[model samples]
Target: MSISFRVSNSSKFQVSEFILMGFPGIHRWQHWLSLPFALLYLLAIGANILILITICQDSTLQKPMYHFLGILSVVDMGLATTIMPRILAIFWFDAKVITLPECFAQIYAIHCFLGMESGIFLCMAFDRYVAICHPLRYPSVVTSALILKAILLMVLRNGLFVIPVPVLAAQRNYCSKNEIEHCLCSNLGVTSLACDDRRPNSICQLVLAWLGMGSDLSLIILSYTLILCSVFRLNSAEAATKALSTCSSHLILILFFYTVVVVVSVTHLAETQTTLIPVLLNVLHNIIPPALNPMVYALRTKELRAGFRKVLRLGLKNK
Candidate 1:
């Protein structure tokens, strides 16, 4: 069967580009909102970069957990870069016009990075599980080679699975309205603009999301469940406290990441009543998680905090 339906004579002009109608109902004065967003982008980028550099330079952080943390930092930066620049352009400069290729590229990057992040979270959960449940074997099990393999699998899985999303979106005939009422070129936001059959595109997206995120979330929960059970079995309260502390940072980051994703996923159901909420949350979801991930780690993880302090002290001594 043909991918796109034939355009009827009554159809409007074909859409070669889309206008991202960022944050509907917000007044022009709200363009000032760009200030906070830009600041957030800077903070997220700076924090993640610092984390990456520290992980690379600090030989003591050569373990699987810190390796995975470095991967997460990179993924966070990619996610932020994918969505933030375009959003800032819309908010600060009113450059909302996105060509078809550019929109598809953005959609692809968003989906790919999101999947990668979810996978990395799962890897981190496993790292925590091993550290708590089998500390002795962790050195043998979660080696640098294993971490490299996991990262490669994540990249391949998401990169291969998410390709169809933009391909299917590109196939649709967008002969109607070209205005996207969102900050970023998301799969649903862009697919909804197509004047032709969108059922395949929607189904493809839903399946991919569930398959990628659903499996990752399920495994992460199982890992944590086992970790908790193992923690409870410990006779010493101090031991238990130390064990749980290792996971606290990861749990917080996971909660924030998945909560925003779940809320954003279901926002379409109440889109009419909560017009700006969905769009606003969608933009914030991409930016906030990346910004908060490093902060949570720095504040909660002792080793990371110490590493950052060490880096700072060395720089000061150099000066």
Candidate 2:
């Protein structure tokens, strides 16, 4: 994939690379915004790595919840790394040009990781549901083997479903403008620049979002609904409080994830009025959750905090 400003052929139909306009109407000095974004990326990567190391070294956290949390940390790292570095380059160095192949790869990574994260959240909700609703069967039902199988399924399901998005997108003939209005190579952003019929790409992306994220969210809501029912049935307030407390962190993360997604989707319809809003939210959707997920878990979940302390103590003793 070569980055060339010149047309490859006499035909204007032949395009080589795309120019990413980091923020459409933002001022030049606003490039300083990269500082905070860089900090978020660093914190996200560092926290996720620490979470994974703590989970691996501590046998006490070898349960379904922590196993899923470990997978989430990995997904968070992938999600953040996929867009942050390139975006920072665009912001800091004005390196906005991306070859076609690289753009398509970013599109694929973003969709795949987003789908995987949604599936993981669903799995985590089921874990909470079982532990709260079916305490007697929780140990038997949510086994290590079962968590492994669920992880494999989440990976396979999301991977397979998201392949068509980038595949269909890449096949399209981008004959006209090659400048994308957003930082990352999003499906809609890239497809909008195509000179050919982008209906197929749009339809496929919409279908995948509904089938993958929509279904996962539905199941999550159902699981939490049942969990709420179970919690309310307990006779004592302390029991109810404990049960709800276990789920609060997960719920907060879920709210953060889907709220941005929904706002971005909704803003697209009215994009003409507020062009920068959707772009800003899309970038935030990728960075904010990853930066916050581990912190939320460590602060709210008792087991995770204990594991974090154990890892910190081990490090101190080693020194």
Winning model by lDDT: 2
At residue 106, give the lDDT of candidate 2: 96
Candidate 1 lDDT tens digits, 1-319: 1122334456645667888878778846658889999999999999999898888777887778888999999999999999989988887788988888999999999999999999999999999999999999988999878888999999999999899999999888787678777888988778887778888987898899899998999999999999999999999999999999888999999998898889988996456443688888888988998999999999998888888888888889999
TM-score of model number 1: 0.94
Structural similarity to truth (TM-score) of each candidate: 0.94, 0.95
Give, for candidate 2, the lowest lDDT window spanning 10 residues: 1-10
Candidate with best TM-score? 2
The list of candidate 1 runs beyond 4 A from truth reads 1-13, 272-274
Residue-wise C-alpha lDDT for candidate 2, range 1-319, written one tens digit per residue:
2435445444555578998987778846659889999999999999999999999999999888899999999999999999999999998888989988899999999999999999999999999999998999999999988998999999999888899999998877787678787899999898888778989998898888999999999999999999999899999999999999999999999988988888888887567533777988899999999999999998998888898899999999999
Model 2 global lDDT (CA atoms, 0 to 1): 0.90
Alpha carbon lDDT of residue 81, candidate 2? Answer: 97
What is the total number of backbone clashes in candidate 1? Answer: 0
lDDT of 1: 0.87
